[model samples]
Target: MTEQQQEETTADQLFATIGEQADNESYDENKVVNEIESLCMNCEENGTTKLLLTVIPFFKEVILMSFECPHCGLKNSEIQSAGQIQEKACRYKLRVNSKTDMDRQIVKSEYCVSKFPELDLEIPAQRGQLTTVEGLLGNVLEDIAIGQDVRQTEQPEAYQRIQDFIEKGKKMIEGDAFPFTIIVDDISGNSWIEPKPADAQNVWSRVEYLRSPAQNARLNLGNPEAPNVDDIQPDEVHTFPASCPSCARPCDTHMKLVDIPHFKEVIIMSTACDDCGYKSNEVKTGGQIPPKGRKITLKVDDADDLALDILKSESCALTVPELALDLHPGTLGGRFTTIEGLLAQVYDELYGRVYSGNNDSREPEENKKWETFLGNLTLAREGKKDFTLILDDPLAGSYLQNPYAPDDNPNMTSEEYERTEEQNEDWGLNDMVTSGYEEDETPAVIEAPDFPAGAPAA
Candidate 1:
């Protein structure tokens, strides 16, 4: 029998056992069939593993299954609904204000997406794991601890910041903070934060519709004909053309729309040049127009600041003014990366340019300047020195997280301004043709270069 079938059989047998016990003695809650011999999936050994199944009847009937292979020490568990699949997705929002909230149970399915906005943190869905609110905090702490160790070696200042976050999380678990919110988006509708008892007063929790089109698409619940790739039509795809930056050969670029979890719309564009086998990738906003041009600036006072998330549009220009760093549009496109990762990229590129073999003949003074800049940048990343990060986007699609936002974060500020006439011209916004041809008119078409063999037709 299949593993699932075997699980059902086990549950049925356990139910029968529970029923037999009811006749002999008074029934008790938490009916469990533990230590049952089972084949080890990991080692492919027979009867070397133990399976534990518990029946939990709360608001709904739930089955908790756990198994462990003593030979390989592999353990697995899952919480499954005895009822039919939920017709709609579920979202659980918890306003954590006291230690009691931390004691609540959290059942996270493999498809649950957890977001902690206060910490500017998000944990993408994975395998189902049963944990309490406090245990969830512990899991986040464990992950940060591992990250801290790596940062300790590569980014000492960021390591110190992570250590501080861990300490703060510990205190928060003990009910130090007044209020924080944790949101769980479960596309499968199998996850939940335990509800407070009816007798409990002033508890904060709620359920709501996910209402995200992208999320519904991810769950494949929006279309009954989904999971069939053949149903896709030609009109659904978007394509454009551009010259390869390396070879200057005509290349076809394809744009695919994607959504960033708990964020805005994005388009991933990919193109490859058959002539030189050069590939290019870039991200752009999904045709969003900000009301006005924006300039965002942030002060990096410590390594903890590096955890900030940035969404830089393709038209955005970024720089570290303190280091005389300037990155304009066309130099680099849009991206979503942590502040620390962006700095590391800058450091690697500069290091290569200064110390590479081709640059060995550079003047001594220039070499000294490059070395000093590198050292200073390192110090700034470690929080030993302070620096300012500025993002200027004429398109106004860039964003930097403000930790104290809606309450005014003192270290960061954002401003909007009108674009200049010259700026509008440069972006081709002012050069549009207002005239349109008649319906019967067909403009002359220019012939495109022959695509390489086996390429999709244009």
Candidate 2:
């Protein structure tokens, strides 16, 4: 058939228009077109169904596209901005203080990371779902309910935990529980939160800022071009040789110096073993090695202190001295974030052990101990009880920004002390294992196992 005839055939196959006929909805204000002779992206079925695109006028011009496959019932929906992309990634934090706040509109793009810190709920972005504050809460509850019903059939305690989270969310929505924060990180800058009235006190007091360069790069914001570390001057390239922990294969390591905010230069080191495909990485800041180990402490007096910056290295140890709480490096990975964000992560880990396990089968005494721990954690987070955060790093990588040391507050303290022999050994600072073996010992050779698609190599 001629090209014109084929085009006419495809257009004739699209018998319905999305704006007027398919759903019989009115979208007179914004332009809505349907049946563009599009194939189902999922099923790859040509001319079997029509795709819908609607321009919804809101805080920004948003183009909504949806496709459904009649053969396989596959469905997908996406939101794209009509204007130019944002120069920088943005974060929106909404304080869910009252029922009125729950009515706030939220335009969550697929690339947004939605999080409810207090409830230990985090929904990472992949698929976009536009919803309101109340609607978001409902979505969370529904997702928890459905997932628990399906996955936790054998674990009654897990179901109970999800139910408890749902109940707490409902209470927050109804203004019964303490106010919580909902933070959304949108790399595309397509997501938005309804701003409160200007007359309201501290209406925009919630945390909002442009994400860091590393963060923007991670999100593929603006398709940032990666820096070529090899292009650096020869003097800047630091190279070392190491044996892989996985297969004992000799590997070449490279450390590229890069500048970070608050720090002049930090070394990004990576080691990859080609033999067994083993890889490891570590970040070290460039500075004179102090004679003594470092100890940093911060007192959390109120909610504002939660916003204090914390840089915890993978080798650093964290302790809440007041609560007799201590966390080692292996328990959690390093993170550069605020006090509240770190606490939320620790809480989620602890919460998983308490509520999302076979706790119902455990002794009553054991359960009580966990409950007491949870109570103590809640007290520390609510600022009802004072707590001191202590960060110790044998290496000078970890840092706790002294809120008062920098400005007016006098509660924070940072000191360098001698590292105990035990502390030094624990971090492998003086361990023989860290040093490459001499010629006397031959390196072990292990065959790399085949990993399934998308699986990490072992």
Candidate 3:
């Protein structure tokens, strides 16, 4: 029989024994425990007996019970030594196999906490989120509006604890509401939108960081510390707040690079409102970069004469490259340590776009000069970042909108999709078994024993 069947058999035995004992004598925890062990051990080894006994919880007399999965992880969150528990965690003693008195005491207490899910517990359900904002704190302008974070980047650990807290507080989820992001105004009038990969292929050698003290500082972080991979910047950057047409929400948009099934490489741009929960992700495929002969336009949206005037003005407009290199990079305001570091440094700080906010909204003509200087900007070159996008047109996304309204977003989500379409379809329709089904074959009609011809009717 299966595990479930074994559990059912064990439950039946326990109840029968309990009933028999009650009829003879009185309640006894020791006797009950002994009976449980005796009957449970003898139960069929199949899963049937093991899986069936949970129903005993509803019995008023069954105050305590124990179960052990043959194979399962222990002390799930982290490993702690007996020494540490003694010093720091009075309640977190280890589960040891010494069979000594101290070991038995520790195991008993720990098992009591673990088995009784209703009791107090200690574990950080959520850990290891980002530690810094870095060079990514700009005002995203989408469709001329601002944007914010509406949902907490879904960390399953956080929500699990949150569920525990809610359970303890006796709060009911009247409706589904999970907000994650925070939306804010474009106070700085600046923002960068781009894709951030959870893990990247490149790493800065120690020598590389030392070459440019300034660049090292940016990658290093707000507070100087030992350099690590986590310190590196992203490959692409974008400005936000025009409003993602799909979600109809506004905020600075950035993408966390994730693998798209079947597709080679693609970047997903997203903007989530902090207040009203709304978000949109625009997946831009890794397209072939135009050859060097391709004609690129710089849509300054300003007049040619005005560009000359600005150059001649007391404060000339800084080139996009200069703006990206010198003024950008780092977590917020550190410095660049190398001339050729990450692509973000090359674009946002050195060769980045710069606008006086007075340029014509249609200055695609001004790009002629930069286009000539850079030559046929062959985008598909090998050294270029893969599965990423480089969009300079600030006006390319004017019509984008947020898809959902506020109060609808979930706070956390699983990194992977839980159920596929096929599984969901099966949910509403269970096994096609018919209720109270009768055998289709006609029951054989037992011929009445032939009565003797001369037999009298009684």
Candidate 4:
């Protein structure tokens, strides 16, 4: 066929499939379209399956599907993420204390496991869903009710126990059980819980952690076997096959050990995901913890101080009194960056967390306070304001550059002090018996009571 005829034939085929010509300009990406008719699993009848390809405003692309059977009146719905997997597994914990909290939106991925600690109930990983808290509980109730009638007849005791649990779940869904906890753990890191202003407090918490090797293997990204560190040399950068945390695609992680002039040796590791353009670098200090903790204080009065390099270990606690910034250990992990870049990161982190969601829900006074704090932080980050930067590390692994080479900077001071018992416990050092653990593990012997034996014999 001619080129024009071929194009016409393709257009005709498209029109025949859809039964109409598609609108080009007025297309809605979120609109659900009938994709196909498939056999219904329940009734063996044909069911209409509709599909929606859209991107979540706060997240990424996801495919929503629904199936309905006219003959059997069967209906089903599910959601699947079309985006790449996140770099870290995520867990969301929410304290449901009111009706508003119950209405919170939840995106539960197929790899997510939800738990209700208060009710001692756990929902294992299943089909992905976009639902509210109450809706999820209602679905659980319906599932529990499915085999209940038969159980009531065959296993009366078990039926009563399950019925009681069902009643409790119903109460929770009905808002009678006001105060409870819901935890969503998603290894794929695609699930999400809607955040409210209450989340800024203890009512809600979200934590992201590195996935275990088993989890990576389950995802089918790469081999779960760990790389041999013995082959890694300090002078050469070792590259290993790995999976990208963001995309779950095959990637490489590069690691090298570098010795600082005045400081100790540290491992520098970096990972770049070509599929998603996600790059990350972290420093790992490898050495015995110092006997004493070190605290470094720098008065940033001159803009030149911001150009100084800094090494903030994972165990370092950073503080800026002037900016009212106090960050605990493990806040930003380990970093080797200039003072300006670090401050900028600190500003960005605080800004993002403070204003992550809607700010109109916050009180005017509280909003104003946060705005002022951010403004001061911005000024400090730009080196336009004076602030005192303090790095307190229990391991004494942190470092700040001294422009005076052999001499200490006039504006900087370093002090070492004994770590407190609480600090040791926090670091898990209190339980560490490096040298005499074998002696401590030896079982103690006990002799029988001779006097008691004699009395029994008499």
Candidate 5:
């Protein structure tokens, strides 16, 4: 059949008239009609339709698969995979009238269309990566030792190098929680962490402890830690002035991202999509690395960052981009402040969040719910005593330092302990299943798995 064979009259709706694109690019024609004719007299009424494929995102990889729709898209994508490890036959969801002997298990979530199995090939590949730590250290090492063998290494030049590495802290990991080192090398081979931040604040260690479920990471995307290294809160759909940066359209596409690091500070990252091959400054930030070179750098959000936002927003019961732009920084030395002062400001921020979420007087269950939120028995006990705060916002440690507030709940009474126990139990169960001792294990996490087919099925 030729590409444009028409069995039925043109649809009532036309893309040319509707104005989505300049032309009709839909899969509309007789090949589909012919296929439908083989199955039933009706074609369009009971035939193929478009569907979104199930997405499996892992560390540095994305697998797209499709689900079958028996002439209509329903009861499809209903067969959820709860992180299953013990693979077995699953029943075909929408099998039509067939003989009892015709096996349906083989039909479940069609892994490949026999006619087009070459499309979704899972070809193997690999990529080399250098971590942020390695990159920064490598640069410093070259700068320091570029001509070291030519002459005797000088003294004050050596001291100056240390100062530069320590103070500049180009992309230091500041965890904002516990004591951690920020070891950085200067123009010389020496490396030392900013020790005062260790005594005064905690940035690196807390960040080191940040472990994520890597369920939706991509392959060869560099270290999984890249996300934390360039940490920004998840993307949030925010409204911008409905004017284009280039064409000045009344309705432009602008989106918002929070906590993108500016020079020694963090700020909101926003952008607009174009309508007419539009013109505007095409980059987000100009070489974040301090230099004479001035080309702007661009960073796009990934699927995992999107997932991170969903988890964080739900866990905190807080809207993503959780820390608003300049919420407390203005009161904390206008943006840049001493470590202690910054900590104070962050504490006040947490206090404000707690105060806003407070509804203790409503009911006992409400009190229990609040207790559940803190995930700390000592904090809950302190809440029972009467929650008080210093001011608008302060850093985490400062809030933890309240004289009247309960100290850290490092004991069994806390929900942290209870949660740990539950997790341990789950881990053991998972181990048992992996060992094949248990026939069917409870897959703890469940999400819709990918569909059976993709445009390019392999």
Candidate 6:
């Protein structure tokens, strides 16, 4: 047998062993179990440690571990993510006001820091946990009360302050503290808060930001040594070792620089995992951002228009006025695909978000509205409906194929305009001083331009 076949067979045998040890014939297909004896932290005695590897629906795989020490009657449990670190760090904020909000599920990875802004309490990175908002608060209370008895005798003032804080936490868990915010920031981007139902008004918000160099180093996700630029040929694909985002298994990523016929050069990157059969690809524009933003509007008159190739950069916002579809920037990331394929992706993203096994929770009116919107999107994807497609890119890195080539396509129009101050700030271009820093004694301040009354605000 080949080396790859041998590896697969070994993996199968290992899983079989784990299944036999678990001794459950009706275990879920997405779950595997194993057990071992480990030294207990409390008693220093051997304790049974059970590990369950399971995949969360709509999310990724995670390992759940539970330990029981018979000698000390101690028990503990924790959760660890099995997926690779994401490209950017994530922060989730949720305002808890009702009982249901306290019951919201939370996935706290080892690198996650949770904060209760109103209570002035912060829980730094510790053991990973899969719990609810109320359970998290309970754990915090337990941790804080550990040495309170000793402190009450030795340091009465400090002990009283902690007792008051613990009382507030208990009230918050009991729903007495009605409105407060819980923030979970994960540098590894593996933590998440359960999203609200489609029909419910959600008070949760999430933001993703680039990690600083120090944060990356702390997470052990720092950049590798830089490669020599001269070694990479423009036409040749360069392959490098990387981890699969889905399975966290070792894989290879291929990248190549390609030039479009009528446009500038771009870097194409692709990754495929042999173990999980997961694949992903993206396009990155080469060189610097353009000085002026671009707006492209296309009138899709027939099926032929849906076959045109398009490049939508990460900074582009797509809109379909007729279909009432407006996708903000960074919605689908960068993509080099045909119009039909892009529309299909948009349909899938929206459909999955609204109808991911929560049909019973949706109101009739909301359900019907979403159904109609999805139906129209499906028709547009199949080229059975005519609609207007608009691409607004502040970086001017997006492109739509002109079927007529040298001659302008009558159905399409393109224009360039100066970017607004807000757009520049969003792209981090305002702080970028390319030259004259050494000779300048002071920095220059830029003032915003005043516009007429009816003009749109930036």
- Checking candidate 1 for backbone clashes, the offending pairs are none
Highest TM-score, which number?
6
lDDT at 292, model 2: 71
Instruction: Please list the Cα RMSD from the true structure of every candidate, rounded to 1 decimal place.
Output: 25.2, 18.7, 34.4, 12.2, 27.7, 7.7
lDDT value, residue 81 of candidate 5: 24
Q: Choose the strongest candidate by lDDT.
A: 6
Please report, in order, the local distance difference test score of every candidate based on alpha carbons. Answer: 0.63, 0.61, 0.24, 0.75, 0.24, 0.77
Off by over 4 Å in 5: 1-135, 151-374, 377-386, 392-458
Encode model 1's per-residue lDDT on 324-440: one tens digit a residue.
566554334566677876776667755653453233334577567767878877877667888999998888877787777568778898899999876565455554433563453
Candidate 6's C-alpha runs over 4 A off are: 1-33, 86-102, 116-122, 141-183, 196-213, 219-237, 243-252, 259-264, 272-279, 291-304, 317-332, 346-377, 384-394, 401-433, 436-458
lDDT of each residue in 1-458, candidate 4, tens digit only: 76655764653332221212123214743223657889999999898998765444334456778999999999989999876777667677788989988888789999999989888888999999989899888888899888999999999999999999999998998888889888888889799876652233246656555676678777775675555347456778998888875556799999998887668889899999876677888887776788999999999999999999999987777878787666656557788999999987777766756664334434597678878878887888787999999999989999999899788789999999999876676566765657755677663322211110000000
The collision pairs in model 6 are: none
- Per-residue CA lDDT of model 6 for 1-458, tens digit only, reads 87666875654443332224254446644445578999998889999998876544334557889999999999999999876788877777788988988988799999999999889998999999989999999999999999999999999999999999999999999999888888888889899876542312126655455676567778877563344356556899999998886556899999999987668878899999998788989887776788999999999989989999999987787888888776656657778999998998888867766664325434598678888888999999888999999999989999999989889999999999999987777566887777888788874543221111110000
Error (Å) of candidate 5 at residue 259 is 28
Stretch of 10 with least lDDT, candidate 3: 199-208
RMSD versus native structure for model 4: 12.2
Residue-by-residue lDDT tens digits, candidate 5, 1-458: 32222311122121012111112235342221111112223333443322211211111111122233466543222222222211111111111112211111111111211111111112121111112332332334456555444433466676666545533333222322122122211111111121111111112110011112342232122364454333343465445455543333455444334343322222333345444343221112211222111111111122211111100110011110212111211122222222233333345543343333223323476445544543432332222222211121111111111122255322101111122333223223223323443555643332222222101000
TM-score of every candidate: 0.40, 0.40, 0.14, 0.65, 0.18, 0.68
| Model 2 CA deviation exceeding 4 Å by range | 1-31, 37-58, 71-76, 150-153, 199-201, 205-213, 219-458
The alpha-carbon lDDT assigned to residue 36 of candidate 2 equals: 55
Q: On a 0 to 100 scale, what is the lDDT of residue 161 in model 4?
A: 94
